[model samples]
Target: MPLSEHEQRMLEQMERALYAEDPKFATALEGSGLRTYTRRRVYQAVAGIVVGIALLMTGVIVPNVLWVSVVGFLVMLGCTLLAVTGWRKAPKPGEQPVSGSAGGSAHGRNRQRRSMMNRIEERWQRRRDEQGH
Candidate 1:
């Protein structure tokens, strides 16, 4: 559910207070755990894919290791699926996914997400301009 105006204001105030109290701690806490988890999952998938390639090469170089090659191919396929899914599910920078009924229908959610991405891109561009880069 979406927060009321008053609740949103209160939350904003609390966030400002927390930032003011300890900037370092706030910065440390800024990263989302979900993002970290998805990144790690994707990295692990890539590692698995590399291992699979090594196994496949070993199977090919060594004689009578057809089963090893088959296993390696399976591993590669599974890991590729995992990496793709993880990447798709990951939220874009500065995009907070709103869970539950607050997002309404699937189409509405997609529209909202698109708009959010646009906003994030705008902010990134503004920051880059500010930094003269």
Candidate 2:
């Protein structure tokens, strides 16, 4: 269920309090926004497309060198795919929860830490198995 306006305000106030008390921890708890493709990603994709277009023009000017443009276009396409699909993959299951240390309820903090540790251990075990160590 969505938080009511009052609850949202309260949460915001709590976040501010946490930020005031400890900026480092608060910033970490703020977590990334839900949407994908940050401004940098979008800018990079735009730059890639522009470069590809430039390469295409260069290829057209030089006879029998269409591969330059083709490669550029492919790279541009790959960047576009990375900007779109690559950004949306959710955090793996049982990842850490976002809760400011000072603001989180006791049970919430415990659960979050436990989940985070479990994920770390699972990843470590996977690496060990893969390396035959």
Candidate 3:
């Protein structure tokens, strides 16, 4: 979901405050999104694999075209490897927990809430199981 205008303004204010309080820390946190190289790597890998398959097909159908298939296969292999490695290292897309005390407290509360809901669900299930209907 997109942020409301109010939320956007609030976030901007918070960011400004963070910058004012500690410019170094704020800068460190900035621009931490996934690197562009990783996206390119994935795209390259998929294209390589597709081209490789096409080349292999052509080589099989035409005489004296084995080299084309060989080159394609190598390209595909290299691209696949690059993509896999890049994707593995990329950060997941989501709001990361804030650093420091609030983060820990928020995480703890979330866990507690999950546990309570689980217990409630289990109790309801047990009651249903006990009933003949």
Candidate 4:
């Protein structure tokens, strides 16, 4: 069944309220641009990994360059460790549901999110049809 116009308006209003009351939750619900994680961190981590790989390779190839190789290996190791830790610590898309109090496993939350998005998308399609657009 399709939602009536009034229901759609009500839903929009409720959504607005949800956003106003808890922006973090609202961002999670919307699924983008909500994370405070910096793009710079990700870029830096990637750069570090690249530098580390180069160092490790150089260390392995050079003749009579044991210390250089060791230095390169160490650089690579440090960069890799830093990148790995940063990646792990980074926030994921839609890290939480609007109602954070709800108890469920990560998989369950994902299902719930998928269902919510499907409903929202369906409503949007219905509206577009109604408008003859």
In lDDT terms, how accurate is model 1? 0.81
Native-referenced Cα lDDT, model 3: 0.75
**Candidate order by lDDT, highest to lowest?**
1, 3, 2, 4
Q: List the residue pairs that clash in candidate 2.
A: none
Q: Please list the C-alpha lDDT of all candidates, in the order they appear.
A: 0.81, 0.71, 0.75, 0.70
Per-residue lDDT, model 3, residue 5, is 100
- Clash statistics: count for each candidate: 0, 0, 0, 0
Candidate 1 lDDT tens digits, 1-133? 9999999999999999999999777755676755786778788999999989988888898999978888889899999999987677655544444345534546676998999999999999999999996
Off by over 4 Å in 4: 1-17, 20-38, 91-133
Q: Point out the worst 10-residue segment of candidate 2 by lDDT.
A: 89-98
What's each prediction's TM-score? Answer: 0.47, 0.42, 0.49, 0.41
For residues 4-60, write the lDDT of model 2, one tens digit per residue: 999999999998898899987776554454223255567777888888788878888
How displaced is residue 73 in candidate 3, in Å? Answer: 3.4
CA shift of 103, model 1, Å: 16
lDDT (10s digit) by residue, model 3, range 69-95 = 888788778778878876764544432
Tens-place lDDT digits, model 4, residues 1-133: 9999999999999999999899887867664432435354567767876776777677678877667667766776776777676556555666632234335455676998999999999999999999996
